[model samples]
Target: MHLRALPLDRAPVRLRQWVFLVDADERAAEAAFVALFAPGQDPGLGRALVADDGGGWLWERHQEFSTWTWFAFGPLGSELGFEAQPAETFFWLYGAPGEVFRGVEISVSAPEAQPPSEVALSRHIDLHRCVSCEVFDGAARIWTDFRLREGGTGRIHVANHSLAHDEVSRLVQTLLEIGNYRKLALIGFPPARELLAWLDGAEGRLASITSGLATGEDSQAVLDQLLALSAEVELRAAKNQFRRGATESYHRLTLDRLEALRERRVPGHSTMSEFIARRLLPAMRTREAADRRLDDLSVRIARSGDLLRTKLGLAQDRQNQETLRGMDASLQLQTKLQGLVEGLSIFAVGYYVLGLLGYLLKPWLHGWPGGAEIVLSGLVPLVLVVAAASLHRRKKRLIAGRD
Candidate 1:
């Protein structure tokens, strides 16, 4: 839902706002919001604003983190009351729902007769790292060191000149958003840095695996290594996927807020854009590089797997061909043995038939004994030829049936 608009009658002379990055789930954060600001009221819209005696409370819930802003305003000479309030003051009163990631303190004041010197600013922030710029086309000036103090809060000072109260509220809101998103984006940095060394080692391992595949090393072993590497890579990617995506989103929003400021740089001093370019942009790039590397590694792993599978398939085909050849040889030998056995059977049958004929013709051929012997010798070739022809025909019929 949308943020509730602020009701401002006039520009505040002095304002102090505290921005907190709450680390909690949506349910717990909403509960905390209701408890801290509107007891018995639901923040179904994800944002709420509450006004009290000379102060206001605004809280918004986001996907990865939530922000709570507390602001107080008073007359120009009125002493700003929140300077003594520590970062834990809110948690102590409302019962902390979650840990805080980033805390920012913003103070707005009327332009002084004399601007604070660099020496005075140095007491609160590093003078060398301080950033100052005119924003809203010189309607106001902003200063900050972007450094956390002992209370774990970064400070921003805005000097108001001609802006209305509503404009100042919008400006503060933008400033708080920039800080919140910047810190949220940085959540990806540490993990990315940790992954740098891991990515280096993983890349080397992948290279070695690829080399082994190219060199025709053991296919199964190489495949196992690739699978293991893929699993590890996926695990790491899954763990950091949300953070990387969130970082990119937050980075873009931070840039948008900086642009919304319409900053004009102060002479001899860096602006917020320059400060972010020097600090946050590099971290964003590092994370982007890690994401690209992870993707590249996955692609290479897939390619290696495909290559290994092709090799395995070729090797299996070769083995199959060899097996077929051996089977063919064995079949040929069996055919030859079957032919020899058929020929022997034919000769055996002929010999038995000759003995029977001899017994039958004994009476008639009592005076011609050599006749039977010559007849039997002539019929021997005929019987063998007939037997061979019959076996060939039978074999042909069997083969035809199989086909």
Candidate 2:
């Protein structure tokens, strides 16, 4: 829904906004919205509802936070003050949902002939830490310390010179966004800081593992270490992915809103843009460095795994070569044994054949003496030749059939 300015009266308006960090449950946020509005009313992304007395509240739901802007026309000639209680106190009293992260009270008034003195501004804001500037091309002057009071709400006082109600509304909305998104962006800082030590340790461990791989450490042991480190890194990345991404997004939005203000410097005071940059940029840089470290660790772990795999592959190749050599030696021995067995078999068959011939010759030799002996002696070589030839032909047939 579009952002609409609060209905303006002759008197200036005072706006109070509370931003809450809600649970991830959409239904819970919706339930909270419905409780605040009419029954069965859905809390979409943005909604504006007004009361009969010309006062209303704007509601907006963000990724993990929601903002409630309440505005009412101020009385005539009212001085800038923080007499009202903080938004969190009121929410706590009425049981508002979610935890409050930021609260801002903005007072917009008609231009005055004289600007508030330092002492006067100090009554509401800490002048020592405040930012004062003219925004919207000098159409309005804004002053804020960006410091939370005892009640946990920041204060901003604006003096309108020639701006209409719509400009004022847009201005206030942008200002609120700057604060809300700035707080949301800082949420990643603590986790990022906590990860610094962890990242250091992980990097050192990875370096050691890499060195071991270089020095011919056990492949299986190195692989185990790499796997364990990779698991822990992946688990951490999965857990932090959402928050880190959100932080980056919110930080960008904060910068955009600050730029949109088109701020001009006030003498002796910093502009809102400068103030935020000074405070927020360092934290964002820290987060970016942490993310880079995580990525670097992942790459190193993958390289280590590749090294281990290569080492194992080479070892397996060597083992296969040894086994092949053993098989070759065994085959050579078997071939020699087969040749010896074939020669012995040929001799055995020849001896058996010669004896049978002699037995048959004994009956025929009844009429001859040396003739049988001579014939048998001559048959011995011929029988051996026939047996060798027969064995050789059978072996050739078997080999041919196999081929």
Candidate 3:
């Protein structure tokens, strides 16, 4: 949709279908072209090395979606709509090499937010509420038609559904003072009773559609749709405004840091070198802010997982140490049990040997007690050894537990 880009004093890029121009001085234009619309920076979709076809550049500097669109200048008074054929040698300028003019056409129509009735179509030219996808099936056109005329610096247009009387008038007045609009016009229907009075005050050919078939009429319905679309756009813009403030604050600090580093350019650290080292991270940070919030969140989650894993490892290590101590204690208990079994075998062997010796000595010691003494000596040594081993095992277990 071709509307005008008016001065800031006027309403900002208003409505769904309009264009406005910037009356930049040569220097301003040059600076804007150099700083904002650098060549090879594709304006559509993503970075695919686009060039300039500079009739004039549209530096769309919204808070979030910053972009530049280059256009080809046409002769004054040329028909400002789609043409069947495009001129071969249209003027073009671009930063990228081997990219000149490409023929594209633009069209503008009045707002027809709803299906036009037979009667309404007969009376007035049916304007589409906005451009459709069908219009740019091939290459798209850069639509710019609103320009300054009659020495009017800029123009402000309050759309057909614009309400808020005091606010609208204030904005209109601001647009006038700021040299924003060339011809400001408020297109709307006042309240019916007020509109009747307004129409009575109207001179020849009052420029308004005040009287209509109430809100149910197709035109009114279309107007409603357009206003709703415009409002949604405005709300999105308002939300972006807050984001822009935060972004600007962050970048402003970053640039300030860069300037400080530049001032401290040392013997070894070249300015370029410093920029490469310090500025690169911040630039990456900026890009991440714009495009990688989810990625950043993912990174944060991963870091959190790592921390948890570390904590779990520490706990697991402590549990393992306790397990090792328990195993050591169990080994000591098993060793003691084995030793006790061996000692029992040794005692049985000793008792059997002593018993056999007594049997042998019984006939020789018929009047002696040497056989009994031998048995008692062997048994006492065995009992003392068993008791000492048990005490040693209990002490070892106590030490292991303390350790």
Which candidate number would show the highest lDDT if scored against the true structure? 2
Q: Once model 1 is optimally superposed onto the true structure by TM-score, how far is the C-alpha of residue 398 displaced, in angstroms?
A: 2.4
lDDT of 3 at 209: 18
For candidate 1, write residues 184-269 as lDDT tens digits. Answer: 89989999988987999999999999999999899989989999999999999899888878899999999999999999989988
Q: Write down the TM-score for model 2.
A: 0.86
Please tell me which model should have the higher lDDT, number 1 or number 3: 1
- Candidate 2 achieves a global lDDT of 0.80
- lDDT by residue (tens digit), candidate 3, 1-403: 1122321221112211122322223324433343453464533322222223323334332222222333333321122212222322221233322211111122222222222233432222222221111111111111121233222211222221222223322332222221211111110111222323432433111112122212223443434443443344344335445444444454444444333222322233233224333534444354334323323333433443354455557768999999999999999999999879866766675566556666666687566657656655666666556656765687799889999
Q: lDDT tens string, model 2, 1-403?
A: 4444444443367778888777876546555654566444455534435454656666666668767777776641334645664545344325657777888888777544356666766788887778999999998889999878755789998878767647877888788889888988999999999888899999999999989989988888888889999999999899889998999999999999999999999999999999999999999999999988998889888888887888899999999999999999999999999999999999999999999999999789868868888899999899999999999999999999999
Which of the predicted structures, 1 or 2, would earn the higher lDDT when compared with the native?
A: 2
Error of 3 at 293 (Å): 2.2
In every candidate, how many clashes are there? 0, 0, 18
Question: Which model, 2 or 3, shows the larger lDDT?
Answer: 2
Model 1 gets an lDDT of 0.74
Whole-model lDDT values for every prediction: 0.74, 0.80, 0.35
Flag clash pairs in model 2: none
Model 1 lowest lDDT segment of ten: 75-84
